[model samples]
Target: MKKIILFPILLIISFYSIQNHATAVTKSREAYEKTGNVIWEIKTKEKLVAITFDDGPHPVFTPQILEILAKYNAKATFFVAGNKAERFPEVLRRVVKEGHEVGNHTYSHLITSKITAVKLKEELNRTDNIIQMITGTKPTLYRPVAGIYNDVIINTAIKNGKFVILWSWDQDPRDWRNPPANQITRYVTKGINPGDIIVLHDWHGSEFSQACQTVMALDDILSYLSSKGYKPVTVSEMLYRSKTNYPEPFYPFR
Candidate 1:
């Protein structure tokens, strides 16, 4: 008799808990929808662009990219995968130490569609914690894995105080596929525009050699930006500049 009574009570508690969670998610989604939190690119008249790298802090390739950036005195944002960053905390620290910005790229590079809302939040929080513990700073920028996102993903990020960052559609060179260095350079140089966010990769799976191409292309890309009199800055820096330099949001959908 006690077990039967306890079972119904437990069921009631579970139902209420689920309902509360659903209500919270719904409220978050509706609230954020009123004022969008997604940023694709920024608009400005000045020759400034934010170049960002995803899936990085690779033990080998990351150092090479940093060296190239240092050579040009350019700053870029690195959206680091938490698992990789945890393994290479030193490399991540170097990225910040060298005056670059870091963003959260999820704990295990999880696909949004494949995970539950709770799981997604867990991933973001875990990555945030890992980054904070290692660098003493929690990332406020988040670029979802494979750039896949939805209402749940956006709301979850905003609830955690992260802005969903995406690159300009034309600025992606797909460097992870290991294209020729010159080709990658040409694609970036030709497509770059003021306030554009360029996306590149600094880490590729086990094959370290695959990421070398991006490092090679980065050297020339930076040189080209210099010749064009364009300044490369971090995403946060670009956003800050937009507030003062150009007061218009450059979202493509708008």
Candidate 2:
């Protein structure tokens, strides 16, 4: 009789363990899709474009952007520089801690559009590895340096199970060149509509601190977008909502 009871208990335990593992698998898949490029191929069917900040994790500018994001309770995606990731690991952590997603922008910020295939993979691998080290998960999303890429780069990202994310050219403002903040705000707010993705900077240069009119314009832009009945969402949340996902182990599902 004792043996019979023990056997049943053991069976129950095994069942629970299997159930838990299945749940884990589901969650992992969800993460994969959220970072996958399915959304890249599909435009924001609604008035929601992803806000992605690239080439960052800089000391001063990164923090400023994070602070504003915190203030507005806004979430955006940060496509980090790999070498900078190693240099300023804390900034990367702060980004995660503050409820934002981190994606790979490559180690050297070399434009994948220009590099050879071998070099592209090497750069992506190194950057993805370092980002995983800091964030505890490898990103399946790849935003080429300076939003630059070709068919080869896009194909490479797809082949590696990564989605190549691009931007909608609504607001650039040339902040990298120290464009005026008011003008930047005017353009971004005026141009923004439903399902629009506004690109901005986080950490970059001394001029970037002055150049990034985005941070300053956040209040006006957010307010305007809100008035227009659009909600600001991070890249991951946008993808997740749209049912975009990657495969397990952060690679192509098929």
Candidate 3:
């Protein structure tokens, strides 16, 4: 009787341990694949770098950034959050009017890896709808929140007929941390190469101060890129002007 009772208890414990271990292992695998599967940069011989701003349409900073871009006659791509765009439709309109490209950054900025396929589709579609409603243009490019994604996220995006974009050059400068403007400028301009997709943030959550630093840094970075004979273009333009047949939809499903 004791042996029978012990056998059942041991079985239960073993099953629980196995389940926990599997969950941990699965999460680790997802992280590895997420970083590995993304496109870091487009391979081309053109002197063009696509500057992409994410999580934006900030009422204050976005307009200022646009002015700076205009002063230099440069174009960029904004990966805007749907909710933010809806809240500030005028800013969205200005972005379109200024000739910059817009891409979807989801509706609520939820981390895509933690969400289900159905939830991912909803997030993307909701944002795409808002962007279309405001700009009258459907965005073909999608950048995942926090730059996190899994197989489900990628597959769902492709199924929805959108291309997933990740930056080739991070140019982070920890601007979200509100670093000094010169540091941010240096981080972007230093060692910048052709066909590099640089990522910057125009909106840092609810705070406008961080965006101020980004604005301050923008002129210097743009000046340096211009001095280097690099033309800043939208991601699509960079790909097209390179005269190379860059792969679309990234890796196709098998």
Candidate 4:
């Protein structure tokens, strides 16, 4: 009687936790919608999506992730910090050389919510210079560190000629926290839809093992996307292929 009672209780608790998580994600998407000039996800029915990796140019794990992406012929975007790119120029170059999109992730990965507009501009310029120095083309996309930004930050980025990018709310698996590989894979693969943007980290400066776990999840994610007849493209490509679906529904949960 105790075992049977506990099992049902555990199931109820698990379901409640998942519901809360989904609600939080929905709230975040609503907040993002209020912040104009950000592209969280495109709206389309063409079976295309974008994969983005942040804080990267890791010499070890980045190459591993790249290998996995190449295996599936999938294209992604890398939002690289200037300090890391400076340290791992070869890895950064390899990311661009292989046809992946590169974006500015700021100079030192400073959290945008706590920084001033001037400081943010300085960070963005420093990162753009580093990326241009290595890749020969300035990045047209910018994703602030920690996905924290306001209208001021967004306008600042626009003045610098960048379109601010954010990932799909449902697609985040918190890989930086070093969750299990299967959990990361399931979260992403399950939430996937046409025009969705999936964010994963390729380098965690202090959490070395976290990126390795992301690399482990990448193979499975790509395999599942391929099997489902989905095409993984760069964020730019997704935007280009997007339909003119205007004023998405208030909830927009899929």
Residue 65, candidate 3: how far off, in angstroms? 0.3
Span of ten consecutive residues with least summed lDDT in model 3 = 245-254
| Regions of model 3 farther than 4 Å from truth | 1-38, 205-211, 246-254
lDDT by residue for model 2 over 81-146, one digit each (tens)? 898889889999898888777888888876434565667788889988998898887887778777
Residues 233-254 of candidate 1 have per-residue lDDT tens digits of 8888888777743223222101
TM of each candidate vs. truth: 0.82, 0.75, 0.80, 0.80
Clash count, one per candidate: 0, 11, 1, 0
lDDT, candidates in the order shown? 0.83, 0.69, 0.79, 0.82
- Lowest-scoring 10 consecutive residues by lDDT in candidate 1? 245-254
Candidate 1's error at 182, in angstroms?
1.3
The count of residue-pair clashes in candidate 2 stands at: 11
RMSD, every candidate, angstroms: 6.0, 15.8, 6.1, 14.9
Instruction: Please give the lDDT score for candidate 2.
Output: 0.69
Most accurate candidate by lDDT: 1
lDDT of 4 by residue, 8-122 (tens): 9999999977754441112344565555447898888899989999998888889998999999999899999999999999998899888888989999887636465678889
